[model samples]
Target: MATSPLQTPISTRRAAILQRTGEALEARLEAERERIGLWLPVALGAGIAAWFALPAHAHWIGLLLALAAGLLFGLLVGWHSRLGRSLFVGSGAAAAGILLIWTRALWVAAPVLAAPVTTSFSAIVERVEPLPARGQVRILALPQRRSDLPPRVRLTLRAGQAAGLAEGETIGVRTRLMPPPTASLPGGYDFAQRAWFDGIGAVGTILGEVSRVPGKEAAAPPLRTRLSAHIQGEVEGSAGGIAAALVTGDRGAISEADEEAMRRSGLAHLLSISGLHVTAVVGFAMLLAMRLLALNRRLALAGLVLPLAAAAGALAGGGYTWLAGAEVPTLRSFIAALLVLVAFLMGREALTLRLVAAGALIVLIWRPEALVGPSFQLSFAAVTAIIALHEGPPMQRFLARRDEPWLFRLGRGIAGLLITGLVVEVALAPIALFHFHKAGLYGALANVVAIPLTTFVIMPAEALALLFDSVGLGAPFWWVAEQALRALIALAHGVANAPGAVATMPNFPPWGFAFAVFGGLWILLWRTRWRYAGAVPLAIGMAALLAAPRPDLLVTGDGRHIAAALPDGGYALLRDRAGDYVRDTVAEAAGVDAPLLALAELGHVECNRDFCRWAQGEGSARRIILASHGRDRIEGADMAAACAAADVVISDRWLPHECVGRWITIDRDSLAETGGLAIYLGEAPEAVAALRAGDAHPWRLPQQLSGNDEAVPKAALAR
Candidate 1:
């Protein structure tokens, strides 16, 4: 087994090269050890947030597991000098911190859980805003007599119901209070949890007319509410709504069509008070401060310019956070901006994963429930992707070259924007599909044009207008802001109307989302060639998303409506002109755009009053009937024949025992427990139903889950 001299030398060199590569990888990891370790808390925080989604009885198990891990990590940290276990200690601290915060969230939600539901209440109108409908309005009121409930409650009023009502005015309203909604489907959106975090105990519609009541308190509205009303009055029409949203986060004023256009064109982020708006405010304040400092010789010479500028930026960001209601996304952005300003003062780069982690940690600590929101997902995903691209190997190699001149900085800036837009679009696409079941076709191009306009033109004008209003000289500034907003809205409409502006995709499964999230985090956090391995999960996630299947039948959360997909590819509504939100949700889940209005354009869906039935052939799985009437109306000979003919029957009425035959029937009892059901057409009647989990979570009262025997499922008995 003797080898030739040439072969031996080549083998030796190959071995040396492999050794060098391994050393280099280790060195890179060592360099980033602290930064990578900073995210230990972030991961723990996410785990804690997810813990709330579990069944109520399962919480003790999670708490025990958390404690075990914390104890284990602490032990490891005790042997730190020998094992380099500082990162372990940090992770343990993070896990403990999150556990405490989760407990706090439950405690905060307790009073609301204990609140009683009543039909009449007297309250002070804390705030009021126009709803999307012509004459509807949303009121945020403070309950005066209900000591057990949370202080704030939200109510919807019909047209002319609150004609003369204003914020801070006491009013007597007769309304039936209802709990915040549970998930529409199993693992779906949980409005109950969101309401818990928002401090809203109940939601209701005002009955009849609202009557004025005498109150001793002042009738002046909060500063932010008054500002929003003033902006709406001055700006006029949809543009005014846009202005109000930019300044006060009152997006309810925007019409449905305009809002849809913005969403389709990927410009909807402009309406939210997020990273872009916060950064603009901070940048403007920083610039103004730097300029002001330059005029002072003593301060400028004392190296105080950067520090002063950072202080000003912090003040502006804090002010904007308050004005925007300190919502989850806005608060996340403010924390990040504050971190960046601090980095700038410390002579370090602001764009780093550590800063993002710090911001996320703070936000999760305050409101762990935010982890489930689209805003939190979208904001964090976009920022992480952009930062990864900036710090990637390719970008580093490009920056290593020193031949470029300063005059080309503008071109480089433009190129950077294009790259960032592309990166962010790609990163956020999977998340959008998982959440909304659609992706904007022109999002990248739209962002390229809209981002700069929003950042430099619209937001700045709005900020200036807000500033001017404080001095009673806001009219001219508002006019300028309106012009900018008009241009932006027009651009959104134009882009949205373009051919193939949005692509409807089937909703990705939870497993697919997990893969994508982990893959992206791996690529961003790891500093070695091993990071490339993340692409494996990324590709798998994309494939899963593309291959996901759509359900054949969809039932609304209230069980008041249902839709069945026809063999010919159109969706038929169970009721005419009702359940608009439900219809749209089902359509999105089915990977169809505009289910209600565009259903005709895509395919035909016949509607009627009593029932909507669809059948492909004489098979049990192919025939489906949804009845809206009661048993008395549907149990007649004609109705019995029709019901007996179908293999699947869904009704809001009670079905007789004799009626249960070789078929699957969902009636009042079933619908009462299961919020909704998604049925997939198959030979065996395969389907999934979403039921209200009878559990002891903070949002679910023990009494509500205890006495609901009808919520249990029962298999059919053979005759």
Candidate 2:
């Protein structure tokens, strides 16, 4: 360079290139070091936090100790590292803080022990069973099972005469209390699990005798309860009983026809203190608060008034119902309303993803057991969708345009309704299938009509009724409210009975539900394109759906009769009792309307004394024949002969047959010259295999055997 800068040429150029390369490599290394230093501590902290937040029954002392160790290790790593040592140390400390918080939470929960058995008490009849055929009665009373008492303990009375019971009637009963049961079969409702999280346990009706006690009428209802009751009474007194229920969660006064109408129209959620009801109350309250605040110059006054308004709304919505003897849904609503108020107080222009996540995290951490409940899942799912949709560019752009025509505004409103319907439907469909095995086809349409009417008319009317009652003008308002409610009920009923209002699907396996939920959450929460990876679970669910096996036979009513579909494309009925459930079960599983019609169309329906006879006539006899009762002795004998000739026979009760072949037992043992196979319907995998292997002709046996043959094959097998 000293000699001549330009003349140094090739050697200089090569040195320069090498230097640049080295600098680039060093920069990359430094960046990598910094990234690791930052993220590693965060990961560690999250792990520690999770460990501490483990269920109350989980070991926490060991976890806390391990978290301390992790912090020490992280600190050592930072000290040893040259680049970004401060960053590493800071991250480690932050992680340690997170872990400490979780650990402290765990300790706080340690005091909660298993609930002790307490003396059983009685409940007064508040409402009779809405569905008489279902034989369920609902009661409200003080439950002695303090540990197992639901936030709102409603007794489900079985095999009891609820008809004569009126409101304010008390009855005593004895029963052992326990947590509600989990869903054991696919597509089965997990009412027990829901009740458990809500703090309910096993509830039974009075066994031998029930003595009715006089109900104590309140001289003056407490301020809040009085207001609620007054609102309800006034609305029903004026508009109709149905209207009061739609607004006040006082469905006891609603007529049976109105209740049915609401269910059919999918407007039932509006009548309950669910998320929608809460949202309406909060939304209107917020609007009113904003207007009032706009009029007030003092910022302090605005803040106080706003929060007070929110609290008032929460009260009106039944958010604090549990504390005031209302309902669980009301409590949930209150929690959500509080979250919204907090967001507003924070001066946020829009609800952020972080805030939503934080709210959900707080709720989940506080009530982890709520994860098992359909209400929590469905409510949160709907909220999440609302948040996402509200933030989307399309919605934002639409809202930004203020100069749009009235027609366009109406169109936008309609669009909003459709979007809401689609989002909620998608979110709840999986849960509905998992729980109810049926989907409401017109849920969206029902919501469109029901939500608006309830929000603008019913709820407001009830609120006004309360004011009128306070001023001694209760009777007039009550009559008006009742009439309005009647109209709403009629609307719901009409929509519910409309053609194709509900779609019933085959019961899916529990794992299918699990995967579907996982997929949905992943899609909803994950921020990256990689989130699409959740589709894998969805695909697996679809595959499961396709792979589901159809049952060959279904028996209902104490298994005295059966409806069977033969391989020869024929349907046969062999039952000592009516086959309605069996027929419906088969039709539902097959996704066919009028299975009998299909059978007739295919010329498979035949009047026969024995299913085996029908099978033999068509030369397409099944390898196995399951008889619900032992009444078909001749059929049983023929089935045994078939078993001797490479077939299998399964019966609910023992069948007497001497000329049959060797019997195949589930233990893989062959009984000499009996032809009767004693294959345990409910056996372990190994036992099933043993039975199959020990049998001389395994393939000749029924393709499958199950206790509940009507259930989908995978679900039945899982049981």
Candidate 3:
């Protein structure tokens, strides 16, 4: 077909305009990449995500490809040549994927997973701490024979039976070690991956009696461990636990009830060694050093006073980190503080998102698996949002009026704290929902009281207590610290007990989380009006809370119990009092408020010890039956009734042959193979096995299906 000359020019002009627009967009993207200084962290995070997206044990291929792509990108970056939009996007994504694959491969390289075994071996106890449950303790041990395994393996034992065990003592253990549990459903928690990164090769309970053995030479108890024990020995009750937690990052001694209170009140962050603690420690040291220097006029005039004070503050932070055992969160705080110090020394603004990004990059490069943890996400999100909000024009305008009266300054300070707390809470709400499926509603009210008390009273007393301990005069200071902690605990409990103080929601899907995260990063990272566009994704992410589909039934991974969705937007339990954790997990996932009450109020479910029956739809719908241990001739009547009444049956014991023709029976063998099941009810009911719904991966072990695995209802037999 021939075209007119006028039409041809118009098409050509349109093509040119489109090309120019694309070039402008590319230019804008490039400018953003340079301005944000977040490329490395984003790339690293993307790599981790890519690794998770792949099939288990398939990271090797991805690693190789990532290596090649990384090298190519490095060369291009080194050449100082402008990249086209396609090349830039491709190279960036490829580079990120490479890091993810590398991290996964590195994780798999642990010797325990290389050649897993389940045999008894003598090990040396590195440390021992009591579990939340009474009469149980967790022991961190070093294996004598399996030197190829991880440096540490966590073992559980009955404290009453293993009372003689001590740190640095050799002990004989008889246990079958196994890998950690994987996610029961997609986007669920992956304890196996977490354990892998924690350097825990295997986890198991002690089988036989513990006996003292002489295998390895004794080593001294860790300095941090000794200090924690000393603190515990000195004080009593929750106060001692709080004191130890503040000083040594050991919260094992804290009671579960108190821990729950803190979590519900949003004072949980106070217990963790984070930026707040680091800042308080450093500020105290800096102020004391400066005052001492002022007292000595000659030293103050030496011109090294400022530098020395900065170094002293940094040294104080490092000392506190060492005291806290240098855990991941503390390490992150130390690195961030160090970056800020360096930036200040260089005569640059230390408070910026770039500092946070730098800290994140360092942590990711050191331990990429941290990207998956709630602590990392929450810490980084809170810090980033605070910095973005405070550094922006809004805060600057609010604080622009300077040299006000003392009372006015005090009021402004309180206002600033309120604003900061609100921003942090809002920013981290999505992450809390995605990871924990809940948000602390009255957290702001609690924080208003707890934060000031902790920062001003509790932390200072702790510092003085530690200082006095070095001089063997710590009792009075320690008492003061305990008093502060007591007050803080009381506040947390009171606030947590408030009605409607916690909001629970279903776990957001991975894509939903991604949308929220990107939306947040968009608002935080961008320097233009386009940042407001982030609200689109944020809204979509929030919509997921209402859009997520609720399962008709939730079965535990071990298949001990199941919860059926009720018409009143609650769950009905098949059992009254077994598998509380499992029941709570299911209820939390379904966003149920009171699991026990929901179960108690179920009118549709009718059951005894032998059999239970429930129907979802009115007519012509499949009926559900829970068949327990009833295999005798008398119980045959119950089985026959279930077969006649229900279309699908889940039995704890063996199923009789006569029932197989009439119903789809999920017996013991089926559950042992599948782990769990989620049944969805509709016009056509569908039962999805937890194992079948998930990918075949290392974290999730394989289950063998025997020839008898197939059990179809007689209604579908003709088909």
| Candidate that would win on lDDT | 1
Better of 2 and 3 by lDDT: 3
* Residue pairs whose backbone atoms clash in candidate 3: 47-100
Tell me the TM-score of each prediction against the true structure: 0.84, 0.61, 0.85
Write out the backbone clash pairs for model 1: none
Among the numbered candidates, top TM-score falls to 3
Model 3, 318-426: lDDT tens per residue?
A: 9999888787789999999888878877899998889988998888777777777899998999899989888789798887778889999888878888888888888
Stretch of 10 with least lDDT, candidate 1 = 710-719
Rank by TM-score, descending? 3, 1, 2
lDDT (Cα, tens digit) per residue for candidate 1, span 1-719:
89998999999999999778756655665666666565665566645654554555566466657756766755654543312244355446545655665686667653453333545556878777766435688888886655544577789997588765678787777665666676675445668777776777777787777767534444556767677778878788778888888877878668878888999999888889899888988999999999999899999999998899999999988998999888888989999998898788788999898888888878877777677678988999898888878888787665454567886766776677787788888888888887888888788888888888878877787778777888988778778888888888898999999989888875577777878877877777777677888899988888888886667777766666666665566566655566556666777767777554332222333335565555533455465553553324544545566667766777777665545423677777877667677777766665565654565566666223111112111111000
By TM-score, how accurate is candidate 3? 0.85
Query: RMSD in angstroms, candidate 3?
Result: 7.9
